[model samples]
Target: MTISESPHEEEPLVASIDVGTTSSRVILFNKLGQEVSKHQIEYSTSASKQKFASGGARRFSVDSAGGGSAGSAGSAGSGAASPSAARQAQQPIFSAEGIAIEANEFLEIEDLERPTNPTLTFPRPGWVECDPVAILAHVVQCFAANLITMDKINGDRVSRSLLPYRVRCVGIANMRETTLVWSKATGKPIVDYGIVWNDTRTTGIVTEKRNSTPQALQDSLRAKTGLPLYSTYFSCSKLRWLLDNEPAVSEAYEQGDLMFGTVDVWLLYHLTANHAFVSDVTNASRTGFMNLDTLDYDDELLKYWNISRDKINLPKIVSSSQYYGDFTVPQCIKPNLTSVAWTLLTDFCSRSPPVPIQGCLGDQSASLVGQMAFKPGAAKCTYGTGCFLLYNTGTKKLISSHGALTTFGYWFPHLENPEHSQPHFALEGSVAVAGAVVQWLRDNLRLIPKAEDIGPLASRVADSGGVVFVPAFSGLFAPYWDASARATIMGMSQHTTASHLARAAVEGVCFQARAILKAMSSDAAGEGQKDRDFLEEVVDETYEKSPLSVLAVDGGMSKSKEVMQIQADILGPCVKVRTSTTSECTALGAAIAAAMAYEKREDRVLWEDLKDVKKWIRYGGVEQGAKSQDGSAPSKSCTYKSQSLDTDRRRKWRLWEAAIDRCKGWMDIVEEGTGAASNSAVKSM
Candidate 1:
């Protein structure tokens, strides 16, 4: 049966909570994909020494290698005998002492401009961590703030007697592979800090596993997990590290009180009042333990890690767009601190019932859904702290011959039969450092006061002035999964200025995205499907005419027209970069998944009605000079057609490529020496 043409319906408003790597947000969207209200809280990673009540002080030391400190926090200590040593002595260590749990209202999205939230603390090189409980508290706070904002907006339209808009469902989109282990009974974190996705401390764990396992076994693992054996990007390696290094974690596991989860599961568990402990297929795909084919934890992979399934609590895998559980307001939010929004939300829930969390997706997959890139070969690039380039491969799970990960895109249970749903798949290329380079520029180099100043500073220079910044700070991901790679700025001359460095940093992000796109295209070509002809057509149209294959972009960095234009240029004339008019596409995607599931639940006829591939053609109406709802199309995106001749682009890309090569093998070379200077050089690079 066909569904109605109107985008709006009686379906209630849906909310999405996006727990990102660098920040957390709660956004509410209507049926037509318009955001009603949003609240955001920014946070960062840290590498500080900690003293536990049970365990004594644990020191995290980074042997200073040389030139300067490696991270943004250490850039000021450049003149010291050893930058790492100097910074280490001055760095504030977060102790388990005097830690208090308090609920801070999530600020409106506009408040994000006030000042940068100091989230990440780099106490030592290659160590990135966050307080998991603090992160969860921020998520709750954002939801409360969003509800308050909604009430303020609704109160203006409706009488005080009437209730504000009700949230019928919630969808969660979270940063994947950031591992956390908490107690199943008490819900307290076993470890004080969460090992962030970009943390490379587990490189030794990955190396040990790879070395211990036979070549054939490693090959089998790659075949099963659809990931290479080198990098520490997955959860299993992080979990392994925790199991070996943290006595608390090991003891908890032995006592059978340990529960493991990626960020999504942690959020879901808290939101549902510890009743629902589950993960969606999209989040499960990145764990490095799930079998790509079976969509379940692989026995052999678990055996390799020496972790028994019964020993620890693992989240149950569920469909991405199905009702998981209901949300319960935590006791921490006292009425005295509650805003009108919270009161309105609680009143609505009391009158009706708690809304179900109907959908969930890993952040990158949700971005793809947000862009409506449902067709095979359709792609997107999200520029957050790191860049994630995802190409939808539709129903087929084409394993990447290249380094890209084969991941579950999304899964919505069939309305009539929940057991028979097929999951969509995508090819993902993760760039370890994207917008984080800008953070380094602002915090470490003191080049710009804010990240937004990057574009203006970069625009002051016509080009990078031969400078190329390869931001492999935590090492390169995808295609080249080198954990030992370090950040490098090459081609600098006496003429180089801050402007040149800023421009180079932006270009570095763009160039890396281009490399991933190239790899994605190559992988798509290798698929040997009918979609190849469509891809060929898109490529042909891009070069011959103005319409290139469109790349729907989102995230903080996508706001920079200069960066987006650079992305278009580096991707060649065949690729058109399109940024969402609304910055909340990631949240909106999660909302869309929830809304779709809600509609399906209400009417089976509407379940897959929107699945028609043609519907996505309207995505980014800015393409081909298409006018938006208003007479003139809004400057939603600043599409920069390839202005440089092919030769010039190639020559520039080659220089950048050379810089990447130079950045490699530095980690290996430094590890051979035990000197503080060598350690400092590695950290400072």
Candidate 2:
């Protein structure tokens, strides 16, 4: 039941399943902190109409958003509608800001818009989604496949021959902030089929609340609610949208029968056969419905949305790694059983004493843990579809000034006792596009034959040749929250090639990340010295207990050595760029949480210290790289000096700033043209 004591004796198996926006994976880790066995299964997103053709020629869509037609899901214009209403539509087609497009010209983006292989479809203009059924089916498939894969890998022959190599506990790390409310009575999702994270349908509800509520009162609500009242991305807006749109949900709220929670809560509910309706603190932090001070649901938030208590099924706020419920396969996957799986499940079920749930943090939180940025100011940037950075702020409630969010850090195992400060806080900033930009190149531009080729190709030239690409494929997010900006590639000339575009794409991502870091520093109340102070503080505390000197990087995209070095060159002055040995930082974070929870520790030491990393670098006096006037690379790129490089990057940022401004008004033009076309439709009728 427990991890074996011997060094070579395999640790008790702990399963970490990552349910990401793009795919699902289950990894089984051994005692040495390495993967023992694993299985990954990819699922498809809803097709877009614009890319679909009956002809066999299979031409890829060049649209920034996914497949759909010009007016379909992946449309270029940001649609107009209330925030709450638009949030539910699931399109990532907003403008430069994180806000949703207006309803009149909905940008129909496909969920899966890669270049190599693509699916095409266009539903009605307003319909966007990830069919709940497909999600459920995928989870089931991953679970079953992982178990089956484990059985095949550790069959009877291996079990008898090598007892050290077996699997043990199972835990899930999921995409937080994505919520769905469904009925418990019928065991079905209550809302429309395609409620995806990027949908911004609930803008109106959020705006109404902001406009109606007094400023002081609203601020109090945010402080009490422990969440911002900005857009429809959070749970409050989604809840409001359901009440406004769906009569059944509205009635359930009235009758006290509406149940809602994020993806993890829903999955656990079904996984445990309704025995567990608990959400770990980290996931709950994202709902904007939880009281930051109390770590409990805010009654006032529910009241503001006019949702009655009895009708909604809510998850209990609990520590990340505690016994949520016993693992029992859902009824649907039960029949297709194997003996090894049966044995494994039976072993897990028979615990005479209840096994404590060891660790539970949101996927982002887990990545923070996995990166070992334990100390205050130590940070990590996770490059997925988007880039999210979390700066551990110890226990302080550092409010954001530059659009960064203040969120609960990981709730350590020891914090479960009432006497402890259960949740730590962090200054968080999220950029909506990162690796997705590379994906855009692969899927949208058809510039790269394979995604992995981007790094080397980008590194071929020292700079991006004055090309600056804002992967505002969806509107911008964090620091500069412009909702109406479209993806724009500026500074292009006759000689500009796809290689320049590729390099610019990477730099654009780094620039966005820099923006997040800048905002987080300002939020921490470290005004003028925010950037430098953060670096120095992190480096000093983490490395030699001196000023901070470098940044630790991880995630799938970190595999690009050129990108990491470029990041280092840009950051300069002991800015160490370190990547993890394993690409599964998120998974590692989950395991660490599970381990800490099992051991009942206050905090587990991080994997890498910023101070220690500072010592490893040999160059201290080198000049940092300079940014050209066009936001392209300078002739000599890798020079690392604090004074020279900092000045130019700041100057280059102005170009980035101006480019954002130039692209901001594009949506109106698209909308007007579309409006005329729509009038023609009416006139024809």
The best candidate in terms of lDDT = 1
Clashes of each: 16, 90
Q: For model 2, how does the per-residue alpha-carbon lDDT over 1-685 read when each residue is reduced to its tens digit?
A: 3333442444256667676654455676654346665544333233322324332111232222322211121121112333422432543332111112222222223233334232211243322344444455445544544555555556764667875444444567877877677777766777645345565666557767777888888778767654567655577777677778889888876776677888778777776633577888888988877887888887887787776666677889987765566565565543333444445445545554433334567888878776767666677778776888787876666667577777866776443343223466777777777877776776667787555677888988767777888888666777676555678999999989878988888888877776776666555545334433433434222212323344556765676777766665555554455665456778767766565553433222211122221211111212224344566542221222232275666566777777777777576578888999999999999
In candidate 1, what are the lDDT values of residues 468-488, reduced to their tens digit? 989888888886777878989
Q: What are the RMSD figures for all models against the true structure?
A: 9.7, 11.5
Question: Model 1, which residues run further than 4 Å from truth?
Answer: 1-11, 44-123, 159-164, 332-348, 415-421, 529-548, 599-638, 675-685
TM-score of 2: 0.76
How big is the RMSD of model 2? 11.5
After superposing candidate 2, which stretches have Cα over 4 Å from the reference?
1-10, 48-128, 155-161, 192-194, 208-214, 225-227, 335-358, 415-421, 525-548, 599-644, 665-685
